[model samples]
Structures are given as structure tokens and as C-alpha cells.
Target: MKVHEIRELLNAKLYVGEGLLDKEIIGAYASDLMSDVLASNYLDEKAVLVSGLNNVQLIRTAEMLDLSVIVLVRGKTPHPEVVEMARENGIALMTTTLNMYNSCGILYAQGVKGFSNERAD
Candidate 1:
């Protein structure tokens, strides 16, 4: 799906990178634990990170992992520094009022995949 498709499904607000709506989202990742995010084998070149952690580091993590979009679950807005970094790094940012679990559920229902609870060996 595309970024606009996600926005349409979630009724989310694009905090930054509004022009990035054309980007392809192959899957979604919902985790507050950045470690787990780092461990996942991401087949999706574009991932909509659904997390409650709103900070500049999250943006860095996203960049390091080559994630395309950051979806702030539970209405958690990123700080100005985070926004600046996201802009500088060309990362798209969005926020939704829905909690993490529900947001993940909705995205899953909409066909976002590539998550497994099992840990990497």
C-alpha cells in the first residue's frame, strides 16, 4: 500500500513529509522496544513504525534501519528536534489517536504484515 492509503485507512495526520504519500509501504512494525525493531528482518523497504516513543532517537533508529515512515501511535507527537531530523533524513512522520495494539490491528486488517512474536536466533 501507499502512504496515502494508510492515511485513508487510519485517518492519520501527516506531521512531516506530506509529499511522501506516494511511497510504497510493504509492511508495518508496531513496537515500543526499539531493540525488537532493530532485530526484525524487514522485507518492506517502507515500514510504518507504530510506536508510542516520541523522540529524536526514534527518528534516528528509523533512519538507521531504512524505514520509510514513522507512525506515532496513541497520538504521541514527535518533538521539534525529531521533526527536524526526520525532515533532514527524508523520513515521513504521521500520528494517530489510536493506541498501539488497535493501530496494529487496523493495519494488519488492511494487509500490513511481516511481524512475528518469535525472537531471532
Candidate 2:
């Protein structure tokens, strides 16, 4: 999936990196725990991170993991500095009203695979 496709799928508000809409999203990782996010194996691939934690460190984690987009679930919005940091790092940021679980489910149903260890099947 592409960044713009995710935005339309989740009815998300694009807060940064409008220019990054063309970026390919090869996977998705949904987690509020920064530690878990940092530990995920999906970092090797281009992915969209779905998290409820709307902090600057979340952006930092995304950067460290080489993620292309951060999806803030449950309508959570990041601070201005978080947005700025994302823009500087070339990461796209978006938000949705759905909670973490719902967000993950929707994305999963849309052919977005989860991290290797996160797969239930």
C-alpha cells in the first residue's frame, strides 16, 4: 500500500509529509510500547507504524526503524515538534479516530502484513 492509500482507507488526517504519499508501505506494526516497536523485525522493510503513543520519541523510534509513516490511532495527535521532527526525517504522519486494535485490523484486512513475530497465524 501507499501512504495516500492508507490515508483514504482510515480516513486519516495527514499532518506531515504530503510529499511522501507515494512511498510504498510493505508492512505495518501497531504498538504503543516503544521498546516493542524498536525490537520489531519489520524495520528491515518499508512499513507504516500504527501506534497510540503520540510523542516525539515515537517519531524517533520510527526514524530509528526506518519507517516511512506513523499512524496515530484513537484520534491522538502529536505535538508540533513531533510533526517537525517527522518532516525533517522524511516520515509521513497521519491520524485516525479508530483505536489501536481496530486500526490494526483494518490495515491487516487491506493486505498490510504485520511484523514477523506479531503474526497470529
Candidate 3:
């Protein structure tokens, strides 16, 4: 799915990177814990990070992971610096009224796969 498509599906408001709307989102990773995101190997694929924690660290994490898009859940508004950081890094930032779980579910149902660290246990 493209960034714009996800925005429409989640009823999100774009806060930055309006030009990045056409970016392809092959997968998704929803977590408030930046550590969990940093440790995931599945992020090698092009994906979007979904979280309710609206902060600069979230943008930093996405930058480190080379993620091009971020969806803030539960209608959380990012701080100005967070938005600036995203803008600086050219990452598409958006907010959705949906909670983290529902946000992930909506993306998943649309065929967006989730990042996983499971080992087939």
C-alpha cells in the first residue's frame, strides 16, 4: 500500500512529508517501545512504524530503521520538535484517531504484513 492509502484507511492527518504520499508501504510495525522496534530484523523491508508515543525518539527510531513513514495512533499529536525531526529526515508523519491495536488491524486487513521476531516456536 502507498502512504496516502494508509492515511485514508486510518483517517489520518498528515503532519509532514506530503510529497511522500506515494511512498510504498510493504509492511508495518506497531510498538510504543523503541527498543522492540530497534531489535526487529524484519524492518529490512520497506515499512511504516505505528505508535502512540509521539516524540522525537520515535522519529529517530524510524530514521535509524530507514522507515519512510510513521503513523501516530490514538490521535496523539507530535511535539513540534518531533515534527521538525521528521521533516528533516523526510519521513512522512501522520496521526490517526484509532488506537494502536485498531491501527495495526486495519493495515493488516489491507494486506500489510507485520514485522515479527518469532522463530516459529
Using TM-score as the measure, the top candidate is 3
> Alpha-carbon error at 20 in model 1, in Å?
1.3
TM-score of each: 0.89, 0.91, 0.93
lDDT of 3 by residue, 1-121 (tens): 9999999999999999999998787888889999999998668537889998888999899898888899999988889999999999989999999999999999999999886776352
Q: Candidate 2, residues 26-121: lDDT per residue as tens digits?
A: 888888899998887646538889999978999899888778789999997778999999999988899999998988888899999887774664
20 Cα displacement, candidate 3 (Å):
1.1
Q: Which residue pairs in candidate 3 collide?
A: none
**lDDT tens digits by residue: candidate 1, 13-118:** 8888888999988778888888888877742447788889898878878888888788888887778898899899988888888888888888888888745554
Clashes of 2: 0
Predicted structure 3, TM vs. truth = 0.93
Query: Cα deviation of 99 in candidate 1 (Å)?
Result: 0.5
Of candidates 2 and 1, the better by lDDT: 2
Off by over 4 Å in 2: 118-121
Model 1 C-alpha RMSD vs. true structure (Å) is 2.5
RMSD of each: 2.5, 2.3, 2.0
Model 3, position 81: C-alpha lDDT score: 100
Ranking by lDDT: 3, 2, 1
